[model samples]
Target chain A: MNMHKYEKWWMLFGSGTLLIFLIVVGVSAFYMGSTPPYCATTLDPENVREHDSFQELGLKQLDDNEYSLTILASAFDYDVGNPEKVIEIPKGASVSIYATTTDVIHGFEIAGTNANMMLEPGYVSTNRYTFKNAGEYTLLCNEYCGVGHHLMAATIKVVE
Target chain B: MSKVEQREQTTDPHEDVDLKGTLFGVAIVGFFILFSWFGVWALFLSR
Candidate 1:
């Protein structure tokens, strides 16, 4: 049978479908790279302190103010796997995080929060986020470093 | 009676194998499939 009669229909459908797919991929790529909302807080894994040294770390204050946080991952703690600690910040503030590995390779990823900043083993990966609401946010190690990778995690608290 | 022989014939090889047209058709179909996949994923599934 001659394919002339059906050629127009085929071309129309084919071209239309192609156009739609191109549009979808373009839009999806745009949305995928977007950062989630979170308050601005700077974190330095190299200088982070425990809850006891809140003032020494310059993180002691409920003044609804914005402050930067510095964290340091030692070789033992970095190697030992355990629950990730959390940091507290105020809502509607911006946060900047810088993380790097000290000993072996480790992963850092925030849980229940829009912070998708990735932490590299030796290299520092920086990411900024703004907190729109007040709540508890946990930091999770996305990549497995070694036997203790499972215990590599932390949290960040957001208050009013 | 004398013995007789019969021969079978086939259509033109070129006519049966449309290399250029087939390639074009495949390319068009592929583009369409990819286009639809992205469109649906972003417009509906992403939401």
Candidate 2:
């Protein structure tokens, strides 16, 4: 087949670009520890509130700069426990967040950060993230649950 | 001019294109793709 030199060059360029993209994605996801949220654990929606973690839904410090945050989503609110109105964590601290919904499916998204998960009624979703900067980040539900979906928001205060 | 000569002259078979311009356009698009892919990777790794 007769082909123009420019066309051949363009084809090579396109293939090379695609290969580079695949390589970068594979390396980042596997080697660099960049992965999607995963939680195989499940619980009854009626008994989520009775669970140990859901009973005390808030941030708890673990050993060596690690923390665990539990959140329960129901209706249009995120129950992040008491005493702390806003989710507060120190900068550069690794945080693992576990969330479950009692009413319907909701989206757990933290603005300006990579913390996002889908909260199902009967399943627990977990995501781990590190707060590298000190700022106030907004947490919102991306999925539409009800008329109060727009009001489903919370604040995350990352302090130094 | 002869009929054959005039016919050949009038038949514009191949179109001329600027090689530099074509390659420049390809390079721009390739750079954009590379930049976007790297940006996504940076965001993922930083999280």
Candidate 3:
């Protein structure tokens, strides 16, 4: 069949570009075992508090410059084991955030950072992020659950 | 088939047509895709 030489080159170029994407995704997911941003493992949502990880819903320092934060999300509020709902950490610290919903679904998003998660009934969503800048980052439940959804928010204070 | 006919069949019909603009546009699009993919991947890995 008669075809433009440019068309032939274009086809090769387009297919080559697509192949690169597939290969990278395959290596990341299969070879390297990378899953979604968070949301790994499962648990009984009804017994979230009884679980070992969720027993103390607060910050735990794993090592220098590294910490783990756990949060329990319910209707109209986030039970972060603090009355003011403010979590303070030193600047440049890496934090692994884990959250789950006790009653309904909620969204866990740290403003000015990439730690966005969805708190499901029986699944725990987690993400690791470093606090590079020292400031107050608002944590909001972007997913609408009830009338108090707008009021359901916390603060992440990265102190210098 | 004769060698002369085979050569004629393989010849590009629009060989004289200038495709510099098309090639440039394709290259730009390809580069953008690569940039976006790697950028998001790196961000995901770090976070």
Q: Please compute DockQ, using alpha carbons, for every candidate against the native two-chain complex.
A: 0.08, 0.28, 0.28
Q: What are the runs in model 2 whose C-alpha is more than 4 Å off?
A: B1-32, B43-47
Model 1 lDDT tens row, A53-92: 2223313343355544544444434311223455777887
Q: What is the lDDT of residue B12 in candidate 3?
A: 59
Candidate 3, clashing residue pairs?
Answer: none
Winner of 1 and 2 under DockQ: 2
Count of clashing residue pairs in every prediction = 36, 0, 0
Write the residue-wise lDDT of candidate 1 on B1-47 in tens digits: 88786665454344454456755676677667776766755543322
Model 2: per-residue Cα lDDT over A61-145, one tens digit each: 9978999999898878988886344988999999999999998999999997889989988889999999999999988999999
Docking class of 3: acceptable
| 10 residues in a row with least lDDT, candidate 1 chain A | A50-59
In candidate 1, stretches whose alpha carbon ends up further than 4 angstroms from where it belongs are A1-67, A74-84, B1-47
Per-residue lDDT tens digits for candidate 3, residues A52-153, read: 889898788999888999999999888888999999989999888889999889999887677887889998898777888898999999999999999999
Native-structure RMSD, model 3? 5.2
For candidate 1, give the DockQ. 0.08
lDDT for A149 in candidate 3 is: 93
Candidates' RMSD to native = 10.8, 6.3, 5.2
Give Cα-based local distance difference scores for all models.
Answer: 0.54, 0.85, 0.85
Report the CA-based lDDT of candidate 1 relative to the real structure. 0.54
